[model samples]
Target: MTSPYAQQGFRVGFDWGPAGAAAVPGSIVAVVDVLSFTTAVTVAVDLGIDVYPYRWRDETAVAYAEQLDAVLAVGRSQEGITLSPASIRQAQGVRRLVLPSPNGSTISQQLSDSGSTVLAVSLRNTSAAADWVAARLTADPSLTVVAIAAGERWTDGSLRPAVEDLWGAGAFVAGLADRGVGPLSPEARAAAAAYREVAGELPEVLHECAGGRELAAYGFAGDVVVAAEVDISGLVPVLQGSRLSESSKPSRFCPVT
Candidate 1:
């Protein structure tokens, strides 16, 4: 019997964080963390850099980077490459980067062993990512795609649903729906509706959302601007093994709904 919590009998699904990702295992999971993590990955992959998502920025992450011969992204306040999409965009000479974040990256790493084909999705690449997933669904109609919004953590380490991530995941969901890719689960439909409601004012909405305001307060408002570049990217960063690289072919432009 299918678990009631799992959005079974649906081609597309939407959920939040690691627990949400685990609920719908073996689906094609798109991890959406638009504020920075996945957005940074999109920018890095667009620049031809391979991204390894690590769960935390610690000694373990440092060792993991060394094992992969990749540079580890530092905290925003620290020097060197950070989670800011702008930082990754301006970075020089680094080909492989281990990006660690509490929300997106942690959920991604948690899903690494769950048999889901993971794609790093953000506002910048939602259309392309949705197109890629749609093509795969065409090839295998049995496949399920779940968009997981990697929300932020509260001061006590609980989930804090971030609207920016909702918009990012919703954008992907909306694109899939536009491509005739559903039978969307109600959660997915809600996400799509959220995106459509704010589609016309995305830039302003993102800039003023809780996540955006937090980043702006930290002087990383430019990163929010980059993340708000909706559908501007054609690169789809698909995870293979532990690293995320561009899909085999460049994605064709597909206008989002």
Candidate 2:
């Protein structure tokens, strides 16, 4: 059997605990902040900069950025900033903010300590990331690309899968499936597509979703819409540590959804 990262081209599966604990050291972790962090990372990539996930929102981030040749500081909150490219340009450390918030970066942080090359991907840049993977895994097509869906939070010895996040992942799987790329298992394809079929409103799609309901109650309709765009930019945000930026390939565009 192939090692997990061997399967992902960088081992690291997408669960919080032991199931994913195997994902450490030399793995390529794709942090999926479908709601916000991933989008923030995408915004940074659109500007043509690289970012790293922060170990701590408090000092480590600032300290790390301080060490970079060029650094930016970014933080995410449900209450601040517009995801629009224009607004992203105007935001503080839009290029390099120490992400410490409710969405994507938190997951990025989890894989930070791991030596894996962490990459932030979404529906918009799913193909870019996938193509990158395909190229690298040409020698090891069995590479495991774990799609971390930012799902529902709970305490029942089980965490729930967020509908919107999973839906996005399904679109990603479908896109890759269409191309017959990577270790995108049938289970992954089904997981992402199964949820894509059910629909009402964006919020309705994410209804019962641990995070989406919260996003709905807080009036993030615009965000939900942005998160669901099938293949908007073809940009994938690969994580260095505290800030995120484009992968090795910037102009390489592919369609996964």
TM-score of 2: 0.68
Error of 1 at 139 (Å): 1.7
State the lDDT of candidate 2 residue by residue for 122-204, as single tens digits.
65677777677656656664455666665545666365555556666555555555566544544465655664576334435
TM-score against native, each model: 0.95, 0.68
Local distance difference test values of all predictions, in order: 0.89, 0.54
Tens digit of per-residue lDDT, candidate 1, span 30-148: 99999889999999999988888888888988888887778999999988899989888789999889899988988887887778899999999999998999999989988999999
Regions of candidate 1 where Cα sits further than 4 Å from its true position: 249-257
What lDDT is obtained when candidate 2 is compared to the true structure?
Answer: 0.54
**Deviation from native of the Cα of residue 113 in model 1, angstroms:** 1.4
TM-score, cand. 1 vs. native: 0.95
Which runs of model 2 end up more than 4 angstroms from their true locations?
1-27, 59-89, 92-94, 152-160, 182-186, 195-210, 249-257
The candidate that wins on TM-score is 1
Judge candidate 1 at residue 250 and give its lDDT.
43
